[model samples]
Target: MKRMVSASAAAVSMLLAGTTHAAVVPDYQLNSSWYSNAQNAISARSTSLSADSKAKNIIVFVGDGMGISTQTAARILQGQSQANNQGGEENYLSFEHFPHSGLAKTYNTNQQTPDSAGTMTAMMSGAKTKAGVIGVSDNVNRGDCDVSSERLVSALELAASQHKATGIISTARITHATPAATYAHVSERNWEASVPEECVGKVSDIAYQLIHQAADIDVIMGGGRRNFLPEEVTDPEGSTGRRSDGNNLIEDWQNFHRTGQYVWDSEGFNAIDTSSTSKVLGLFNSSHMEYEADRDDADEPSLSAMTEKAIDILLNDTHQQQQQGFFLMVESGRIDHAHHGGNAARALQDTIEYSNAVQAAIDKLDAAGELDDTLIIVTADHSHVFTMAGYPKRGNPILGLVVGVGSEQPSLAGDNKPYTTLGYANGPGAAASFDAGVRTDLSALDTKQLDFQQQALIPSGSETHAGEDVAVFARGPQAYLIQGAIEQNVIFHAINQAADLGGNAYVAEE
Candidate 1:
């Protein structure tokens, strides 16, 4: 009986020891096997390419809805034709010249093609989530999600926690989906400018949460001044929109007068002393700033200008010297809106503008000797259903109709045609008729076509999101981590690992 009792005690002790050991060690070991395989494959492709040390600053450029096809289409429209005989020029979108390039699958759990909220949330937090969801997971209660411990820390928050200065610049409203995902938490992505009646008098709006919760927002630029102002402030159209709160949020921002500077126009933005100002709030337009093509002034800063200004201010912080680095997120968010409106001209122009912003970052960082120290990553949150198909003549206008050649073209049964101008799966301006024989003037068509055989899917109107993978171009430290196909959330992890931001607490261990 004594020997049996001793045996039982030994078993219990062993079991407890095993449980303690498991608790001490992380269950999910760092699986370098995949990384090692990728490294080997990379070595086989190029001997010159090698990973660099840790980056000092990280600049992420997200072209809101600029998918891979969008990039390809933009390249072609920007004079890089994809023809065999014609001399096609290679016009790099600044970051494309980077030593590393990769593809990222942009899909949320709920949808194959995700909205900016879910996609950006993944990029910012390094966690997969449902479509239309922003910041927090679907499991968390909506109102408490932001302050919940289960909520994942954003890359911006992580950088701030490490003492780095952070900034978010966008061409859309500062409270728009992409930018909002980085700082604000809500059940829906569209909650940025939204004010629920339940919390109207008691709690702050998402816009307020964005500015107030952000511990180190050195630069805040873009539109959505309507949300910031009281009902009294006349909008750009000279009318007062709905205001849930009697308190003017813009005035609230100004109350922090000594610590911040607010600019209402381009001239004001340029006049501000970035050297002296630690915090800047620039609202150039009442809503989204004018389209890049529509802008008249050469002196007026574009999205690129705002990005440069943000970087300048963030890097100037003297306190937390060790955290002297800056993490800036710049977004060309209007691309998606333009696509939704079925404005090819506007969409492509926005793409070019986005590329220009990327170029500006490259030039500024290069000039400041920060290019090598900065990990500049350029990508899109998701893609639109925008496509370019049909065999047009070499150097043909991308905005023009698709013409088919005789003999080589597919047979058209009784006036049924084989070519189309442009198409969408389901958008507002989709091709109205299925019969190609109905020769509608291509010049009058709103959206472009994908050129698939049989019936072409039309978009509801101007916009549609694509479920395709987006391109990621990277430069500087650990850029190699961005090679090959990867999940959208992996981008945050790669950035975190490259910057040594530490573990992803959101990812559960198997």
Candidate 2:
């Protein structure tokens, strides 16, 4: 009898412990006062509101290659430079205004200088992998059938499983690397145009899977219409020089269209009825949409305009009460393109446009009283090699040569010293020649020199990406999780923890 009683007591204790663990809430605490206030606001709401508010909506804004220096350069070019004598500082971008901010280290397992495919795969799936790998683990050999269940699930996929609406907006082709990381899986990132033969009958192409498999992605904007259309029907210029499946995908989409609405240009996009629509497909260019600076009024919709339209249509679902919300991913993808091409003017313009989109989202959410309940995260996937130096007069134009150092300085004697405005650490276009005619003044030169001089090395004229930590800014609940330096994949865990979402889908168990 004594032995039986002891066994019963042990069982009872185990039951009690299990019950207690089940009742415990996940850890979603904030480390900063600002985030604490936001958390208080979230908890104080009525039970019904709070219940629906458990991350009902998530909006992630990715500045493709716009790192800290990119933001500073954009601000300077926009006349909001910190050097300006204006008394009041320039207003923060919508994302910048977020109360919590953190930094993320971007590097792939295989490469120091990472590509968008690997970085975004980590961002979307929470798993770190090699440079060219996407949607799957680097541990899995490229074409091996015996790949591990180590596959990571995207936040969008998780939200879809919970009956939430999901949307992907970008300035690049819908099938581009960053956006594709959210839905498609493959060993290679360039597989956008190539659909596996096995996937043909079993699963649609990645593009089709994104539109069909999940919760009928409500809003699909940006370019890559050619990928959807068959070769015969494709516009000459729209063919991305890549072919897939030998079938026009655009026709397939149209045939599969149920309540879907399609818009090819800005005019058609503007004509859509956001209040009554549930599904929208707007592909403005045959490839990626034109850059914001180069896009004609008739051809493409502005990033801000597209963002507003997406929000309007997403909110149309009767299911999204103040408590139940949606999930949106907006990408300012062209900044990376501009940097790759080494066009400073074009890159800065796109950055400004991206900032405008952030402001637009803030205005819409604030007006609807949803800002406090919503968590806004803004960050870049990686850093670029761009740098600014060259001290000119107090009011000198940022584009001009540096005033106080280098052989280009006017005040410096022959072969003495001068200065330049721009610099790069590893760029092919660093300054190597000491041209006397391009000299400037060098009176107040700083002791430390710039990262690189103009026309110094390879002369390719384009800056490259650096292996450095990039900044992450946040506002709303759990903003404090973004403090100090952290690995890039930590972002996924921080966001999941703050939203009270469970599971370590990406991390390996010790």
Candidate 3:
């Protein structure tokens, strides 16, 4: 057999040229053994993976900025959180065992690394748009709202037209880029509450579109209360509303859907009678919801709780004569925010919570006997610079210092100091600019703390989104589409093809 070198091993060789044993680094761990393991995994998938002939309900779980490295670290953390730290590497975060998965190239029409608006628009609208734009084609200039003719239709709109009951659940503001891409059309993603002074009257902000552009939502739950209320109405959080139009959209929502119930806290969210209520509207926090680690101080529901409620409500409609199944998007949105601050602990914790939410949805569907009838797709809008590096043994603590094979103590880096197992490429963790280059000594710090920020190579104002591809895991109808490297826009097409939402449903202009 040819002596084929894995790219990972090749990189290691290039980095350690002229050093003895450069030809082989046991710690690098990309040898024939790795090849065999990967091949075996693929063979297993071929035998066990099968898509449902039809999917009556579609659930898309978005873990924003959750790259492959993030997933690995989070999976290990989730496993370690268990009693006695049993089988960390083998611990499957809900979607790890998903039958079908593929890498999605997340580039936008104009940029290599994309913003949430463009990446999510690609997922929701079957067309890759420009960075900073949402639910509109590349023809529209950012911040210019007069592109009504260039506005792109979205998967949620197609679901609405198909008579499917739908829901949106997120840890982000309801009007944030990810959720807004599902329904709203705007040249700029930041137009969540108020349009630009120049674009006013010509364009509707994201919050406005959530109500006016898409009136058929069966469940709407997230934060961003400011965007829905009048300035005079102070929320329980002591913040004023952001709506400049003076419209109390919450009141409008109540009046418009007289049968729907509006709630702002966990108690109210928990009290909703999914069996009796025609619709549900929940706004947990004044802005973005608290991170899962900080949720103990408030009555805001967890991602899992909200997911169950949405699934139950969407399922309740299936008993109605007009029900055409459902489409639900659940986002573990806070992961992106945590990564922005270079807080690896919070980011991984959010990933775990997001996994719990996905498990909750699967459990709910299974209990309702809708498992086979529903399609669940777990993916990220794009990747962050999150990485798990250093040569840690299989059972070493994911958050602790890396321990090389056969070594009981943490290994020292080239700087002769211990480094963390997880780190960022560039973030607040970087002590100085890239030109200066500062490395922190993490040997004495508690890297497992929820507030801990991992080390980075380049000091940035904030960590940046990565240009690398993200993974998409799928089950149920049309899951076969997610078998190899794919364009991000294929997500919308796969769902549309499976649900029969009519071809080319995302074409801009009516």
Candidate 4:
């Protein structure tokens, strides 16, 4: 069921953007109905709007490459799916209803349109860094280990230090940029399994850091199974592991957490008892996990399933009473990958799935009556160059061609060719790739297919990141800090404050 909450709902009036004086309604019309409502909304949140004394739990959802347009498109696509729907603009994703939201400047120190490694580092470590660095200061070079001595501690590390349970979940490889930022510190995001020979002894690989440097990951679930196993170890899929190192990190991780269970498939994942089990490590794929649209091959758990399991395990059944709170990061990592591949359908599908995962977490929190104490922050690491253009009529299918208001045919371009409503500014879909002089008419094509790639302007093998600010949506305790146009590092501050990790808690550790 759609849990509809009025944007003007009390306690959330101006919490998201933290703007109370009316961003839309201008001019001082004190006698107008709009003015009266605005006043009431501001008055509504005046009672208790301070940061939480201490948050019992914290969950951050990063929909990689989910820009403003991606979010808007997904919201409409999801809305249009329902039998009872208006123009679709009225439709809201589960997390969109979050009382607190703000814009985050996603650029890194070195690049305008940031990479996941740097952007996620800002959010997870409370420090802005260069484009390709992970969990380290911006002073280090991309591949140089000589300056890798200084590492910025992450919120998860701090949470772990405070004796709180910590976990990371993703649709991509667990050792990928987003999740790795929560734990690993390395010069390059690509150094997953095989560290370069020159830096082998000096710099540890990401997968190596996951088992060694990371805080006690109570509920680690994602792909990147090959990165942990040795080269001789054959994965369940018959693919050999990538580690040149003789060590099998999987068994080592299991041994590190004596009671922890290592799982590599759906059967093992689903059968585990999160209540009695304090730790879980599951890698479902050899590398990146399958997209939601293409998961028929195996009995893989959906993002929602993984989210629920992580939440359950972190909560520790309350009876165990071993951990006070938890910090979890859930990433829809393939949204960015699909965009880079120029597949709009896959990206939007993954965004919807990310929304579903957020909803699942919300449901779990509500069921446990922890909504008041658990802070939920949903944002993105960066954005893609994908765009939604060619204005179509209201309620038009988001993935369909741009149809004129009264005409049955789609709008024609300068070359007399029809275009799709969704497309990339520059990507593999660009017409230049086929022929510089010809434009393919998309009218007859199955643009709505799951594998469909939106047409682009330039011919690039992969789409590039867009240099624009992404959105941050928050709910629960201390979410008010999420308001206003802010830098990406502010996210770490908000979460750190909410969880009472102490101001700049990790600085002392460094």
Against the reference, the lDDT scores of all candidates come to: 0.66, 0.63, 0.79, 0.80
On residues 355-445, what C-alpha lDDT tens digit does candidate 4 reach at each position?
9999999999889787788989999988888788877988878998888788787888777877887889899888442475577767678
Per-model tally of clashing residue pairs:
19, 31, 0, 2
Off by over 4 Å in 2: 1-53, 80-91, 142-150, 195-205, 212-215, 236-241, 318-323, 393-395, 404-420, 426-456, 459-463, 501-510
My TM-score estimates for the predictions, one after another, are 0.80, 0.77, 0.87, 0.88
Quote the lDDT for 84 in model 2. 49
Q: Write the per-residue lDDT of candidate 3 for residues 1-510, one digit (tens) a residue.
A: 123334344534432322221222122222223223333333344356664476688999999889888898899988887887655887889988799899988998789998899999878867777999987777778878586556555677667667778889999999999998887778988888888788887878888878865536889999999999888889887889988889888888898888789999977887899887868889988899999988962589999999998888887854356778888999889999999999988888999999999999889999999988888999999999888888899888888888999999889988788888888889888863223454567777787787787888877889999999999999987677677877787787677656766433222233
Query: Which of candidates 1 and 4 is the stronger one according to lDDT?
Result: 4
Estimate, for each residue in 301-411, the C-alpha lDDT of model 2 and write its tens digit: 988898888888877743364224677889989888777655555677798899889889888887777777667788888878777764454434444455653334343
TM-score head-to-head 2 vs 4, winner: 4
Model 1 agreement with the true structure over 1-510: per-residue lDDT tens digits? 111101133432432222211111011112223222322333333345555588778999999888776776676666643345242334555566778888888887678878888889878876666676666664544453232323444677667656677788888888887888777656655565555666454334567766554444667888777777666668554646345556576677777656688887777788877666777888766678777767755434688788778766776644235455888899998888777765666667778888878888888777877888888889999998777676665544455555445433332323454444344555655455444536333334433332212123563544578899999999888788788887787777777767866433222234
* Candidate 1 Cα misplacement greater than 4 A, ranges: 1-51, 80-89, 141-149, 199-204, 235-242, 298-300, 317-323, 403-421, 431-439, 443-456, 504-510
Task: Report the Cα lDDT for candidate 4.
Answer: 0.80
The full ranking of all candidates by lDDT, starting with the best, is: 4, 3, 1, 2
Give the number of colliding residue pairs in candidate 2: 31
Global local distance difference test of model 1: 0.66
**Which one is best on TM-score?**
4
Pairwise TM-score winner, candidates 2 and 3: 3
